[model samples]
Target: MPRSIDSFNRQRLITSYFSVTLSITLVLFLLGFFCFLVLSTQKIANHFKEQVAVTILIKDNAKSADIAQLQKTLSVAAFVKSLQFISKEEAAEKFSKDIGEDFVTFIGTNPLQNAIDLSLKAEYAEPEKLGEIKRELEQNSFVSEVIYDQSLVALIHENVNRIGLITLVFSALFTFVSVLLINASIRLSIYSKRFIIKTMQLVGATRSFIRRPFIRLNVRLGILSAFIAMLLFSLSLWGIVKSYPEFSILVDAWILLWVFLGILVMGILISWGSTYFATQRFLNLKTNALYY
Candidate 1:
């Protein structure tokens, strides 16, 4: 009968420890996932912004030498990501295909002007910045006009800001909740060892001496939980990359490393703090209170 009871208690203890580890893993995974989401959103926003281009129309009588100089100057500009020179004929061909009609043939002349289509870097893609750049470009003698889609720029800027704000607010709330959940889990796991703490105190062990082993154990558990969560996170990222190859651009190995380290730091801090506090309560409890 005694052997059976001891076996049952040991099995129960193992099960409890497994459950606590699993809980910590889930919370860490959630935190890592939200971090990835915030990062990916920023990448996607930059991708869209870089796709916007300004069309610079050249004057009818602009010299080829002047056009070449303008192209060289624009290529070296801080704001420009890239530029392509479209000759008047190329512009007419594109326009003809776009409208599904040979307007040049119908009129026996191409009214389209030679133009430079240039995309700005993400940082310079804002409306105010683009406005400043446009004014600067128009000051050139060979330039006739600089045009871009104001409505599209405004829409992208607004939507990106909105999404960033929303993610920040929700990430803060969820991170707080995650800390609380982790704290509760660590405390509960320590609660099972309260009697051992009390016994050590009665045997004349110093508080630090009593804490050392439990703290070490908590640290180990925290690291183990972090690695487990990271493993799951890596698998999820792999699946996403496989399903949508374009997302591969957003997957930065350095950022993923930071995410993994962040989770590990969080795990260690929360577990260590919770274990220290939980042990304190037991250390102060009177012998009779142990029954409760």
Candidate 2:
């Protein structure tokens, strides 16, 4: 009968340990996922910003040599991410294809102007920089006009700022919630052994001696939980990369490494701190208080 009771208690203890470890692992995974999103926000924004193209239309009488010189100059500019020259013939063909008719042939002339599609670097995508670039390009003798959607540029800027602010707010809120959750799990696990702690104290165990094992055990649990969380996060990231290969370019390996390390350190610190404080609380309680 005594052995049966011991077996049941041991089983319960193991169950409790597993429960606490699983809880911590889930919380850490969510926190780490949010951290990764926060870190990659800027990169994602830049990727989209660089896709907005500014078109420079060429004058009909522009010499080929002058147009080539202009292309060479713009290609090396600090603000330019990439540029593609579209000849008038290519523009006419594309328009004809889109309309399902050869408008150039019908009119007996190709009216489309030669143009250069310019994609600016992320930093120069702002309204002020774009305005300066447009003015600069329009000053060129061979350039007829510089054209881009001003409203679209403004909209992108507004949306990026809004998204960044919202992400930061959610990151902070989730971090607080994660801390609370981990702390609660640790306290509950310690509570289960409150009687053992008191018994040890009654037997003349020093406070540090009592805390050492609990703290060490919880720290190990914390590290294990962190590893589990990181594994789950890596699998999720892998799935994302598989679905959208381009997304992999936005996430830096060093940033991911740091996030993983942060999770490990956070797990260990929170577990040790929570366990120490929970055990300390029980240690300071009166023997009679144990019943309540």
Candidate 3:
């Protein structure tokens, strides 16, 4: 009968350990997912912004040699991410297809000007930098006009700022919740061993000696939970990329590094710190307080 009772208690302890480990793992996973979204938002936004182009209309009588020279100069410019020269013939063909009519046929000549389409780097996509780029390009003798959506650029900046603020606020809020949940879970797990901590105190064991083993055990659990969270995050990222192959470009090594690092830090910090504090509570508590 005594052996049967011992077996029952051992099974219960094992179940409790599993439950606490699972709880911490899930909390870590949630924190990791939040960081992934916060980090990748900028990259996704930049991808959309890079599609906005600034068109440079060339002068009607500009020599081909001068156009080639201008292209070379623009290619090396700091603000230009990419540039493509569209000849009048190519522009006319595209315009014709868009309108479903050949304007050159009715006009007896192509009316469209040769143009260079410039896509600025993400940093230079702002209205102020775009204005500077426009002014600089317009100074060229062979360039007739530089055109882009100024209002659209302003809107993009405004929207980006709003998104950043929202993400920051949510991150702070979620982080606090994650820490609380993890700390509570750790405390509950330690609460189960309140009697054991008291026993060690009665045996003349040093506080550090008692804490040393619990801290080591909890830190190991934290590391394991971190690994599990990272595995789940990786699978989630892979599934997203597989479903929408177009967004694969946004899956950068640096982002992954930061996310994994964050998960590990969160897991270790919360688990180790929570275990330390929780253990201290029981260590300092009177024997009668253990009943609660």
Q: Which candidate is the best by lDDT?
A: 2
Off by over 4 Å in 1: none
- Pitting candidate 1 against candidate 3, the one with the higher lDDT is 3
lDDT-better candidate, 2 vs 3:
2
Tens-digit per-residue lDDT, 1-292, candidate 3: 9999999999998887787788889998989988987998899779767877999999889999999999999899888899999988999999899999988998999878999999988889998989998999899999999999989999998898899789978988999999999899889988989999999999999999999888898888888989998999899889989999997976999999999999999898899999999999999999999997
Position 222, candidate 3: lDDT: 87
Q: What lDDT does candidate 1 reach at residue 286?
A: 93
Cα lDDT computed for each candidate against the true fold: 0.89, 0.93, 0.90
TM-score quality measure for candidate 2: 0.92
Can you give the lDDT of residue 75 in candidate 2? Answer: 88
Off by over 4 Å in 3: none
- For candidate 2, the C-alpha RMSD (Å) to the true structure equals 2.0
lDDT of 2: 0.93
RMSD of each: 1.8, 2.0, 1.4
Name the better of 2 and 3 by TM-score: 3
lDDT by residue for model 2 (1-292), tens: 9999999999998998999899999999999998888888888889888988999999999999999999999989999989999999999989999999999879999888999999999999999999999999999988999999999999999999999999999999999999899999999998888999999999999999999999999999999999999999999999999999988875698879988998999899989988999999999999899878
The estimated TM-scores of all candidates read 0.93, 0.92, 0.96
Per-candidate total of colliding backbone pairs: 0, 0, 0
